[model samples]
Structures are given as structure tokens and as C-alpha cells.
Target: MIMQKGKVKIAAVGLGNRTCKYLRYVEEHGESAELVAVVDPDPSKADWAREAFSLSSEHCFRSFDELAASGLQLDACIIGTPDLYHHELAVAAMRSGWHVLLEKPMGQTEEQCRDIVEVSAETGRIVTVCYILRYHPYFMKLNELSSDPRMGKILSIKHIERVGKDRTAHTFVRGPWNMKEMNTTVFFTKCCHDVDFVLWLTGGQVESVKSEKGTRIFTSADAPAGAADRCVRCAVEQGCPYSAVDLYLRRKDWIKGFVAQPGESQEDMILRMLDESRYGRCVYCCPENDVIDRQSVVMEMADGVKAEVVMECVTDEKDRYTVIECENAVITGDESSIEVTYKDSSVPQEKYDFQWTRGMEFHAGADHQVVKEFIDSIASGELQTRTPSSEALASHLICFRAEK
Candidate 1:
């Protein structure tokens, strides 16, 4: 995984919505990284990448095997495939002597995650799992404050991932990640970042976990009596908050490349997708959609720190609210701000605020920050893979245990 000519030549295995961030990074920061090739089974995605990166036809591969056989020089590979394919793709990339920037929930199962860790160690290839929150300014500040002596030793922590109802419908209800059987659990698919953040902030290994999960709203029995299977044909589509027509058509830019195809107008694509694709499926009536809409897990850490993680898909807003209690003070924050208050009467409560003035700034600008770090690490050979497979596995094991 050696850098050539001061730039890290990279290839993206999956060109989905998440991978767009990496592609954009390489596009903007040509001095640091170069996107040389892309691989996806979908020819439309290949075409999108080719135009996005100005890649040659020879550089567009339909599969990883094709890329490998092409003998293209790559310093690293970004694995943005679906959850289940992560283990195999990551292992193959590492074995091929390319460093890996894998998307989260390292693998579908604990054993698969362990296999990735073992392969990474065996190959001496850098494997950074995309736990983007670690790079976010707010969470980074929280980590720094936790280590301050004035904050005292941490006692317990509570983290809640509020997946807004609109997001739940767009993603978990009718999108690619609608079911546990086809993908993974809601915890792994959505809240693995939360789990990884808990591990990062606590700096302790989880000892045990107890969890309870269920779906309350998005089920067949909960569907309105007059509802149709697809929102485009439904009588209440106008008033429905989770209407596929409104989501895909009205909010075209929200998920641009994912729903809208190349050369197709937003209105036309929205109509076609709604009429033909699973994205148009009614939330409560989609039989194949079965992931839990809400869940909570209680975890005991090795250092006797108690932590509770709650994931709710029905919330009105999408934000991470975290409260960490220490021996002398309590710290609380969301994506944009943080506040700390001490028990001592003489001490005053302190607050820190952040400004999200640009695009993809919701996660405290971690979306691009993580990409910068990965590119810089590869270029300098410093390789600061903050969340390596072994580190990521701890959080994943907790998820696996809790699900049981």
C-alpha cells in the first residue's frame, strides 16, 4: 500500500450514496488523493463514476476481480458495498496489498468481523473502518473533555440516536436497508456508529449487554385501511408524511444519485421509481421490511461504567444526544453544541457551540474530515486508522450479544 508520486491512488469498490463522499473528496483535493478506478455491478453506477472522476473506460470495472486482474496500481481501496459483502471485499483488498477504508458495521456477523481483523493483521495492511463520528469536531471535543482532570473519572453515559421519521421511512422503511433478513439489524445498519462512539468515549471494554427491541409503527397491521402498497397510487399520499412521492419527487436533492438516474429529469425519474421500485412501497404495508423501529441496550463496561444506548426511528429530528456523567460534573451535547456543569457551587456551567455553515456538516464535518485523514495517512505512511478492525470488533460484539 505504498503511495506513488506523493499521491495516494485509490479505487472505490461501491459507488453508492455513501461512497459519493469519498469520490467528492478525491475530486476536490486532487493534491492529496486520486480516484483511479471504480467497481460496481451496475453499469449505470460505473458510468456515473466514470463521469464523476473522468475515469477511462478501461478503469471502470464491473467487479473486484476485474479490477484486480487489470493490474492497476492502487494505494488503497474504499469498501462501500452492502453490509454482508464487507468481510469478503475487505479481506480481498488487504490480501491484494491495498489498504482499506471500509464502511461501518465492519461485517454482518461477529465471526466475519474477526476474520477481517485476522486478515488485516496477517497482511499488515491498514484497515480503517469509517466511524466518522470520531473525526467530528463535537465528538472530538467531547473526547478531549472526558480526559480533562477537571471532569474527574467518568461514571456513566447515555447515548441516543434519534433517526427522524422521514429518514426512517426513506432508509429503513422502503429503501435498500428495509429488512433485517436481507441486510443486518437496525443496530448494525444504523447505530453502529453510536456503539463505536460509546467504545471510543468510554475507553473501556464492554463486559455484558442486555437489550429489548421491537417495531411499533411500521408494520402491516398498522397500515391505514385505505392504503395501497405503493405511495404513488395511495389515496392519502398527499397528506402522508412518509409518502414516497413527496420524498423522492419533492426532496430530489436529498438522495440525488441514489434515486434519480442519469439523463432523467427529477420528476420523470421520481414517477418511474415510485411506480416500479421498492422505494415507493408503503411503510406500514411493506411485508419484506421487518427491522425494529426502536431499541435500547444496557451495557456494562470492564471498568464498571454503565452505559445505555437508545435508537429510535420515530423521532421528529435526526440528531445524536449524549449525556456523560463524571465524578464531579455532567457533560451533555448534540451534534452542534456541548454543555458542562460541575457539582461545586463556585463553578459555572460552560457551553460550546458549532456552526454548520456548509454541506454535509451535520456530523460536525466528519464526513470530509475522515476522508482527509485517510488520504493523509496513506500519503505519509502514518496510517492513522483510528478504528481498526480489532477496535471496531468490540462494539460489534456488543451489538451481536445484545441482539441475542
Candidate 2:
């Protein structure tokens, strides 16, 4: 498709917070990219698309079918819908002759992921998976050090993703993703990024994985006595760390998902959302939450480099930490910075640090970089996407195996 104004014309299939962050790239780099259309079932998101882009009602569609029927000429489509919808939306967009930039956890199952790969090949439409760590500065540094000649042959890697208490409660325990059927399991939903990071850093696929994982604390057996069904009315909610009253009402955090209704006050809207929606449910009382709360995996890569990955929702803070041990030196990093220490004695620099900057700090600027590169590739008429569905399948299969 020939884009107008020399910019890559793109339509966004989902207008949630994740897609909204990606759309920021289009707004900031207007000369190279354009958001020609948007689709979402939520009225609040439609209102956002209209105001954010000065879009006419015709340009803001309620579904991908509507957007496709609108006949807007587009070079690409961004699929950031829920996990359950990824395979469907991606296949539809690609079959419609538009290349796709699909969000992570490409599909809910191994069969679905393979089908997406097959369809992308059959249609010859580019499919770029959103593994943000591949673009993040911090993880990029880890990849650099893993391959640095001075660091010597790689040995092993230990990576941890701290999903944290508040986020786990909001997204996994009581949110739309609480049940397996609504979205995928927490492993695929969250740890796909972690697993993919290791695969990228190692530059090899896994031979086998020895893993142990489960929902540790968010079960009925762990609930306290006299706990109310919802946190709004629970007497025990006062001292609870995962209190919805504390996170939503008093601090007003994690409310980004629920926007205020057209004429409703913010306070009244939040109150109504808490009482009427799943967000207000007590964390311990959620028996229907089938997604895991903790996971640990030891992956043996094809090159004999072993990587251990740990994902947990019990941490006080949310971040990723990695340690890569090589023959001559040891490298370590949290999301903020990296450090390398040498084994040689009397070296001029026994140890040093590494840090990265950001144009937009969201996802440590990975979101911005992912969108920027995808748009550039499309605008340049590049046949191969940077993160292809074939490459992403290696990492996805590991998470899918967790079900067995």
C-alpha cells in the first residue's frame, strides 16, 4: 500500500493502555508514521481514540471487521487485543493483506501459535512479535555482554521477573486475566517476555526445561477468617497489603484500566467500578483465578548454556534482574543498571557499570523502540520483520509446555 505523506499508514486493532503506549510513537514521530484508524469494543477507548487523534466517528471503529470494511488504505496493523483474541485478529489482519505487529504471547496455546506461523507464511504478510526486552536498553546490554569477546565463552544465566504484589492483584488475581479462559495462563501472559529474553541473550533454543510452578497464596485455603467477598466491605481490608481500598480508592493507582464515564466524577466512578466490577474483589477470595502466582524454570539451551528463570508475584517491587556468568567475568544487572566484574588480578578496571537512556521511559523505552523499528521497516519496504513469528515460536513453546 502506498502511504500518504511518505509516512507508514497503520491501523491499531486494540486501544488499551498497551496499544496506547505504542501509538505514542506515531504521535511523536508523525513525519514517519500515521495512525489512520483505531478499533476497540470499549466506549471509553473509542472516546480516547476520537479525542487523541481528532478522529471522525468513521475512523474510530468498534471492531476489526468494521475497520476492515471501512476501506481505509493501510500499510500495517497493530494487534494488541486480549490473549484470547490474538490468533483470530492476527490471522484476520494478515489474510486481509496487511502486515501485523502482534503483542506478546502471540496465542493462548501451542497449536494456535503454530497456526499463526503457518498463516503468516501462507499469506507472506510480515508478523512481528512484541518481545519488548529485545528492544529495551537494559536487556540489550545483557545481550551485548553475553557476546563480548573479552567476557569469554558464556556459562549460564539466572533471570528473575518480579511481577510484584500490587500488579499481580490488579492484573492477574482480580482483573480480566484472572481465569485461564478469559486470557492465557499467567506463564504465557507474563513470563513469555522473560523466557524470550533468555532465548535472545543465548541466541539458542531450549533443549529441555525442568520447571516447578503454581498459585501459592491466592487460594481459598490461604484466606483469613471472616473475610468479606469484596474488599470494599471487608473488615479485614484495613490491614491487608493487597487491599483494593488502599490501591484504588486512597492512592488512585492501577485505575488506568478503568476510565471515568462521560458525566461521572472520578471518585464516584471509581467507587462504582470497585463495587460493581471484578477489581473490587478480595484477592484471597478469588478461587476462580486459575493463573499461576509463582514459577521457576531451568532451561538447558542447545549450546549447553543453562538459564534459570524465576517469576513471582510476591515481590514488594516490580523489576527484572539478570546474572550472566562467563568464563572470564561475571555480569549482573537489575532493570536500572548493569555491572561487570573481571577475574584477573591487578587489572586497570576490575569492575565497571552500564546504564541506558530513554526517549520515553515506558517499558524502559522498549515500547517506543519496538514501534519505531516496525514502522521504519514497513516504510522501507523491508520483507523481513525484526522479530518474526518463526523466531518467537521457540520461546512460546516453552510457556505452552507448562500446561502439560
Question: Quick one: best TM-score, which candidate?
Answer: 1
Q: Residues 168-221, candidate 2, lDDT per residue (tens digit)?
A: 999999988889888767877888888888888788768888889865688887
> What are the Cα lDDT values of the candidates?
0.84, 0.85
**Residue 370 error, candidate 2, Å:** 0.8
RMSD of each: 2.0, 2.3
- The TM-score of candidate 1 is 0.95
lDDT of 1: 0.84
TM-score for each model: 0.95, 0.94
- The list of candidate 2 runs beyond 4 A from truth reads 1-5, 348-360
Please write out the lDDT profile of model 1 over residues 98-180, one tens digit for every residue. Answer: 99999987888888999999998898888998898788777888898887899998999999999988888988877778878
